[model samples]
Target: MKSAKSETLKGWALALPLLVVLLGFLLLPIVMITIVSFWQATEFSIIPAFSLENYEFLFGSSVTYKVFWATFRYALITWALTLLIGFTVAYYLAFHIRSSNVQTILFLVCTIPFLTSNIIRMISWIPFLGRNGIANQTLIGMGVINEPLEWLLYSDFSVILAFVHLYTLFMIVPIFNTMMRIDRSLIEAARDNGASGRQILTNVILPLSKPGIMIGTIFVLTLVMGDFITVRVMSGSQAANVGRLISNDISLLQYPSASATSVVLLVTVLLIIGTLMRFVNIRKEL
Candidate 1:
């Protein structure tokens, strides 16, 4: 009993730094924001008083619902595309690639874009997808269409494309990590039993990769939900999202309202992450 108690104390000592950081940076801010969310906002400044006026205004506005809906739409689309592409890429790297060196090289290549600024990478797509950009010009030169595609840029398509480009790596890394840990003997045994590729994948690999999928889902969903810069730049400020709403509020010095909106977004994201946690204990998998 004494040894176990000592070990527990050691574990707590080891975790002390992380606990302090989390409490100082994360939990404190969250608590402050939650408190501010209920405060009253005046024309000139925020008043420190308890009230649901901010939330009342939020629920009363149709624009709030529209912004949230648009945010969810973008998140769902981006998550689906990233999951599909990431899974395919991870599967190839884990199973098809024989050499560890080559796999590492390829994985590093995949991460090369991340070394630069996300803003720069997002803006780079503008010239390629613009009205007279390379994409439209190529199509026109090939007689594919007489006019440039108006929907190619400054639309939902461009926003989703930018998201997929930026966030696919998040999905790939986790899924690949999970795949690498899977036992090769299980796969060989399944094959020896005359199980087809589809059967083996469905019955074995998919089940084992759930933790990675859940992690990836949580990452992509939270990212897309909270992102406004990509949507702002890619959509030419034409699109609306919850993040944009909060940003605009902050810009106008509506701290209380912005805090309320942020609180709502945080709660929504937490609910989603909690649901995902029910399916996979990420700690155990890791």
Candidate 2:
């Protein structure tokens, strides 16, 4: 009992720093935000009186619903694209590539683009997607269309494209790591049992890759949901998401409204993560 107690004390000693940090940085901010969310905001200043007006206005506005729906649209589309592309790349890297050295090199290649900041990568797309940009010029040169596609840039397409470009690696890395942990013998056994490639992929590989998929989903969703800069720049203000809504409120000095929106977003994300966590055994991955 003494040894157990001593070990427990030692573990608590090691973990205390992280616990303190979480309480100070994470929990404290959330508590403050929740409290401030009920405050009143005026033209120039915030009033600390308890008020539900912020939330009432937020829920009453049609724009709020539209913005949230748009945010979900962005997340859903990005998640689907990232999942399909990430899974394919991870599958190839995990199974098809025989050499471990080659896999490492290729995996490093996947991360090369991320070395630069997301803003740079997002801005880089503007050159390629602009009216007279390479995509339009190339298409025109190939007689695909005579006119430049004006909707290419500063639109949802550009926003989602930039999203996929920036975040696909997040999806790939986790899925690849998870796939690498899969036992090769199980795959061979499935093959020996006369399972086709499609069957094996659908049944053997995909079923085992759930933890990684869930992890990657969480990462992608969290990033996409909280992102304001990417949507603002890439969409050229043509789009409005919940993040941009919060940003706009903050810019207008509507602190209470911003806090309320933030609380809603936080709750929304937590609910999603909780739902996904139900199906995934994260311990297995750990």
Candidate 3:
């Protein structure tokens, strides 16, 4: 009984710092945002009074609906691309690479680009994708096109491409971790049983990789949903997203409206994550 009590105390002591940080940084900010979301916004200042006007305005505005649709579209595109590429890369690294030294070297090479500033990395693509840039020039030189590709820059395609470039690493890391943990014997056994590569991957690898995929999905979705800078910079201010909308509101000093929008976004992301969790109990798999 005494030892159990001591263990409980030790656990609580270890958790106390994390609990405090979460309460102060996460829960507190959420509560404050929720409270602010109920307040009234005016031309000059936000009034500290309970009102549904913010939500009402948000829902009644067609622009809000369009922005949300665009945001979801971007999120979906980024998620799909990242998952596909990440899974392929991770699979090759985990299963195909025979030498651990070579695998480590390749993995490090993948992470080298991330060592630089993300903003710089994002901006670097502009010159490559811009009109008269490397891509357009190359295509033009090859007589592949008469003119530079306008859709290559400052468009949905560019935005999604940038998102995939930036966030694919998130997917790869988690999935690689999961894949590395998989039993090699199971794969060998499947092969011995005359199971093809496709069959082993479908029936064995994918099932075991669910936890990592869930984690990667959560990361990519949340980051894409909350991102304003990437949308602003990559889309050249032509496209609107939930984050960009919230940013505009904040810039205009419409704190209440921004808070309301943030609340809505938070709820939407939570719903997505909750739905994903229903399909895969990540805790059990982990």
RMSD of each: 1.2, 1.0, 1.0
**Candidate 1 to truth, TM:** 0.97
Q: What TM-score does candidate 2 get on C-alpha atoms?
A: 0.98
Give a tens-digit lDDT track for model 3, residues 111-165: 9989999999999999999997999999999999998999999998889889999
What TM-score would each prediction reach against the true structure?
Answer: 0.97, 0.98, 0.98
Instruction: Compute the lDDT of residue 86 as modeled in candidate 1.
Output: 95
Model 2 residue-pair collision total:
0
- Candidate 1 backbone collisions, by pair: none
Q: Give candidate 1 regions above 4 Å deviation.
A: 1-5
Candidate 2 residue-wise lDDT, 17-71, digit = tens: 9999999999999999999999998889989998899999999999999999999
Off by over 4 Å in 2: none
| Candidate 1 per-residue C-alpha lDDT over 16-120 given as tens digits, one digit per residue, 9 for 90 to 100 | 999999999999999999999999877778899999999999999999999999999999999999999999999999999999999999999999999999999
- Give the local distance difference test score of model 1: 0.95
Computed on alpha carbons, the lDDT of every model, listed in order, comes to 0.95, 0.95, 0.95
